[model samples]
Target: MADGRVERGNQTRRAVLARTVDIASVDGLEGLSLGKIATDLGLSKSGVFALFGSKEDLQIATVRAARAVFVERVVQPVQDEPAGLAKVWRLCESWLGYSGRRVFPGGCFFYSVSAEFDSRPGPVHDEIARIRGDWARYIERLLDEARLAGGFREAADPADVRQLAFEVMAMMELANAHSVLHGEAMDYERAARGILTRLRAATAAPEELPERPPAFDFTAGRPSA
Candidate 1:
């Protein structure tokens, strides 16, 4: 009987965090309120407060929950792939898909919330910065792996790899912004093309890179693969 009660409590907490992440993505973490979330979820405000204790605790939990979603959608999908240029490429594509698919109504949760808290000093800011740093290091590690596999040109430097990762990230964010503003999917195609072109240039064996269609056909209501 005690185990059942614990399981139910865990489920309620998960549900709360799921809704909290979506709300935080759209309105920024500063906008979150336990009463508002409780009302939205049709639960008692006191119950929600019991779960999180405070708004800051709720925000922290929301960030952690969103990070778990990110890992499941972007990182785990490509984890088993050959760890080299192909795996790196898969990571980029997965990220694009995650944003384009609207995993969060406001788009990339981290991207949206990071901008909100970047200049502020607090536990929330520190946590978001740590998440961003971890992602950057993951990209760098993938690039290093590709270099070790001889996929990149001998002239490629570690610094160059870092720059490329930054460029790819920029393209992803740009696409997210444009798509959200204009409601157009073509932005993703443009981003993908830019990433593919950059990767091809650095590739030691360009032929090993995935083939793209001759042109993107937006009239068909879907971009060419």
Candidate 2:
């Protein structure tokens, strides 16, 4: 009986988090309420409240859950790829696909939530900021690794890994922003092409990346393999 009860509670928690992530992505974490989520999920308000404890706690958990989905969708695929210019390019490609395919319904979960909470001061804002910082650091680390692997040209300013990562990340965020606001993915192609140009200029192996942006069926909401 004890084991069964625990398993059921875990299932309920997962169910609540799944709904909360999608809802928070589109509406921001401040939009979440225990009562409304309980009503929508047909679960008791007290039960949902018991699992999360407070509105802020629920929002924090939702952000954490969205980060997990982001990792699985964008970061994990190229995890084992050689840590060189190719890996960096592939990682950016994954991010574009994740956004273009609407993995979060609002494009990038962090992008929407970060803009919502960027100026606000609270635990939710801190959580979002920390995760975003982690992403920036991750890109910077990849760029450093690529340089060590001799993936960059001598005259390409490979020493400025931070700037490269910054530019790449900025382009990606713009893609997500434009796609969500305009309901079109023109920015994805533009970002992809722009990034490829930057990467090629940095690396001696220009052939390692596509000459053009990867083909995508934007109407079908798919990015190329």
Candidate 3:
């Protein structure tokens, strides 16, 4: 039946997307190829081509797939946290764990791929830009939540807090790149502690600094709403 065919096609599409994200993370989108994907997954060349008519389509699908995995692994976990300084810390912690555990094998997929595609222009590049914008907006929203919670001073601009969030994320990505290249893990831990130090300085009153934990357990599930 045509319906059966459609269902089977959808299954194959999902499988392809799963593999695509992992492969593209390490190899870059341009390095993604039908032959390689098919060979890795043990699928026929025609079958892979049937799901994605061209390489570009496969690349786009890979980005979409990576987005899904990212949300499940990172965003969804922190979505229900009460928005404030706590939520901002939750976001940073989640990202560190996401990278620490090697969720993408090659590290943060967006961080790795975005740099690879930054100067390039196309639908793929557009999608990367959109993802980055979404993340920045989310950080800004967290800063707004902090202001609403009185966690931040009234004079603090949400825009400025968002920029600070980006700096922390950049440090993590830089550490990830170096760690992956050198097989070292200490930088990841240092990056996390450095972020916490900056956040404490930002949020704490002159005499109300928080104590540092020996190790942050970023792997914990999101706090229930």
The weakest ten consecutive residues by lDDT in model 2 span: 216-225
Q: Model 1 over residues 113-156: C-alpha lDDT tens digits?
A: 99899999999899999999999999988988898888886667
Candidate 3 residue lDDT tens string, 96-153: 7787667887888998899899999999999988988888787778877776667763
lDDT-wise, the better of 1 and 2 is 2
Models 1 onward score TM values of 0.92, 0.95, 0.88
The CA lDDT at 208 in model 3 is 38
Q: Write the per-residue lDDT of candidate 2 for residues 128-215, one digit (tens) a residue.
A: 9999999999999998988888888764454499999999999999988998999887889999999989998888688887777777
> In the order shown, what is each candidate's alpha-carbon RMSD?
2.7, 1.6, 3.5
**Candidate 3 ranges with C-alpha deviation above 4 Å:** 204-210, 213-225
Q: Rank by lDDT, descending? A: 2, 1, 3
Better of 2 and 3 by lDDT: 2
Query: What's the residue-level lDDT of 163 in candidate 2?
Result: 91
Q: How accurate is candidate 2 locally (lDDT)?
A: 0.89
Return the top candidate by lDDT.
2
